[model samples]
Target: MQQSPVDGLDLVFYNVPHAEAPAELTFAIPSMKAYCGSEIVAHTLHNLYTLRGAKVRDTLKWVGYLDQALDHTQDTEIFFAQHHWPVWGNKNIQKFITVQRDSYKFIHDQTVRMINAGMNGAEIAEAIKFPETLDQELSIHGYYGTLKHNARAVYQYYMGWFDANPANLDSLPPTQVAKEYVELAGGENAMIKLAQKAYTQANYRWAAELLKHVLNYNPNNKQAKDLQIKTFSQLGYMAEASTWRNFYLTGAMELETGAPRKGVSTEMLLEMLEHTPIERFLESMAASLNADRAKDVDMVINLVFSDLNESYQISVKNSVMHFKAVPKAENVHTTLTLTKPFFLKMVTGQSGALDLMFSKETKIDGSRLDLRRFFSLIDKAPGTFPIVTRK
Candidate 1:
């Protein structure tokens, strides 16, 4: 079972042979397709840019689905969705689908036109305004994905990440830039004074921006930190979009509670590894490598997942890690053979690598010292890193 796209309720699909259907009855709909009786209502303004996170959705593709839904469901009497009450009559269903469908189409088409006219993401996000009729429609309201974010996502999808500006191409990382800003603004006390004034003026955005620099410079600044919590709380309360509200309120809660207390558990890590493609998992490890620690290290290790019947070689060179899914190479620093579960446990800190080697859960050949050195260079990342405050 999976939730319908817009209404956010469970839908269950059942299989039926073609011979069982009446000549007039069909399951296929052009864009908004479904199986059996599980019809999806394009009732709500579906997430054009989902905040909880996923690939940026193609609003045009979604509109195409709606077009198909209109052609297929014309004769249907009742229109039901996951979250909201069903529309009982044919006319009402048509009205609901037509308005919702057109709203998405308008947004998609207008954003594309703006992009072709040489508008950037932020410009497009601010420029596109909904038609008065659609804007006033209760069904297609911005209760989830708002116009501001959806427009930006559309622009990014078409134009890519570069804003066609050279300044953004090689910008300093956030912490470095924040430190510079703090120094330029005459240190913590000066920033705190400015932020406190902004807070008083109800300019929460500026206050949060300034205080962030202060907090990044000194994570222990109680006054700056407390003001940020207040700013996030106010922003959370004022937000109409559910996702925006959740993000702000959650940030406040994290500040109050000292970040999320949970780390990736062994079971969770194992489940993730079990489902992930081996090549993708290896590629991800490059991102997780502690480059500073591994700067001078150059080694290669053969990994054999015996139970899964997979073999790969991992190479570390010039502070970068690379992997290929080929037969294990003979010349290597170490060769470790283990089941996928055992590997997950060892990596997630649930089981000691040396203990696993001794227990025969992991069979290691070649230099044990090389394996130890390699593991030492791997940084132990905290599960819950601070966001609003310094780590």
Candidate 2:
């Protein structure tokens, strides 16, 4: 929880009573909200690594570990995080983390238990809440992340993928649904006016939900777009979790335009990726390529990243893909040699296509023209559009 300089976050918005009214705006929350990026991202990577096995190399000694547990006997315990006030004593830190761990673990465990008892995911989220004492506790709070969403994540872990609903099987996409909702709830202008009222009354959460529909219905509606941005601004200003603030701001940016990829620092993700299946990563890579370039140019490119100890010969036939992770030195389009992290960096677009050309990091020798052509076929991973439905 030690805060870094990158941890500082803030969001600001105007305080108009309604879209029709003009009024002064100010900082929604009057405090500095900060957190450690390395810490949060490391934890996230670990969770994913543990939940779904990842692939890492023995030669590469480090993954994403940011901190080491200080010897309790030598280093005195007086603080927790850099931004927040601290408490002394190892007993205190132990007590603090005990409740923190139990809170998330409780929601996770109990929600799964309830799912086994036939309560759906949403039901468990509604019925479950952290103990009142824990609710009052600052560190274990919904300000950064919520118990509600996490509970649903737990239910999804144990239960079947769907909520057992036939209606959801063929439901319209969010944008389509939002358009219908806006028409039913009056109109674009009406929703904007109402959202402004909710925002002004310090009812940010509701404002967010309503304005989201408005923006989705009319993405170019500046009034609705501005209102949605302001809503996320307020939420970001109020958030204690740096991750939450980043997500909100990212969402706001996407609302103004279509989704854009903000590639993460690949160093850490690459380290954790070793535990991932070679075929899955290649599949994801194939999915990442720009398919339009290869619409009429279907071909196969076998890629072998030696340092990752992985091999995948990717074939694109009739727009259907087949990735096999077997050793083959056949007449292929490309034979690349690089470490896991750098190759992944290239795959995620964090590094440029020619950086490898100018640098000593990686090499691409065979059929360079067709290799580029084959790499052009895949698509990137979709946005915060739920990997699995929780909304």
Candidate 3:
């Protein structure tokens, strides 16, 4: 769609309909390559699988967007993206889009091909590699999304989480495995000694790995924690990608000083709540429920948002929370009415139940005890929860 607000300028929009991918809406000027952030880029490979976690992107739909941009902007002279500088000249623009498109397609196709050929995720990741001609290009280098992770992402996208290995199907959890490893390796002191040796040899990767095992087994091990801090710092300094470098450095900082006790900002809380669906929010609440604490507790709470004109009925049964958009007011233990602003304040720690009740911001229509019990079942993660160090 092209919209001209002025006499001689038109902004054209290009995005895949009903699909989640980068540069949800990109603008294009006539005879200029569209500025597609992740859809099409000039330099540095876009994250096919985002580092911070998101929905799996549709590679086919992403490629389709690139094709649409190409067909519609045939007279383009140069292109630019949010992540990097511009690529000038028609030949270079064509080549950039072509390479970017093919890179994603190759990863998706080859991963599926290997899957059909009986190769699992690890094997496919090890086997897949871009041709030398493409890999040598500075534009699509593994600065963000490494080939290994993207390959694994593709496999997981197509074939779900289970790898069909019976042994892996019922393996012990991380803490259990860590305890076993510590015992088998002669305890925390012995593990720390080995990690120190690895650190001395500049094998920071192995050092970090070993330290994680120790921390999991005995979180109070000061030696293990200090060594992990050093190893992560070294790893951060050596990383090329900004995201990778930042994460590593942050991990080290948290290990040394603990996670910050900063609360969510008003702007951030609003943004998150605005984009998140009601169903997803309820699902997250369900996930965060303290099952052991709520084993014998059951309650129904009807939440009515006055500002948004929306209502949801939440029911807890078997220590799991279930919610629906339409109100099921019947048999409800309590019905709480509050505006979006008040709800935001309460959730972000700016206000509490007492403030809401005292200020009449949130009106409680039924048993306050039921609401109190429901709230107590939701575990409150400490503001400065551990990250690099064990919890």
Q: lDDT by residue for model 2 over 158-253, one digit each (tens)?
A: 554577777877788878888898998899888888898999998998998888787667666888777777788788778765566777776676
The TM-score of candidate 2 is 0.57
Off by over 4 Å in 2: 1-94, 113-123, 136-139, 200-202, 238-242, 249-284, 289-312, 318-320, 323-369, 379-391
- Write one digit per residue (lDDT tens) for candidate 1, span 1-391: 1233434533432222221121112243224333222222334566666676666776766566566656656765666554567676667767787887788778778988998888888888888899999988888877776787888777777877898789999998777888999899998889999998998999998898998888878887888878889998888888877888898888888767787687766565676667767677566667788889899999999989999899999889899998888898899999988887777677667788567658677888999889877777667666788777764
What candidate 3 gets wrong by more than 4 Å, as runs, is 1-8, 17-23, 31-42, 116-118, 200-202, 262-267, 271-284, 327-331
* Better TM-score candidate (2, 3): 3
Worst 10 residues of 2 by lDDT: 58-67
State which candidate has the highest TM-score.
Answer: 3
| Candidates ranked by TM-score | 3, 1, 2
- TM-score for model 3? 0.85
Q: What is candidate 1's TM-score against the reference?
A: 0.78
Flag regions of model 1 displaced more than 4 Å.
1-43, 52-54, 78-90, 116-119, 175-201, 261-273
lDDT of 3 at 361: 74
lDDT of each: 0.74, 0.57, 0.76
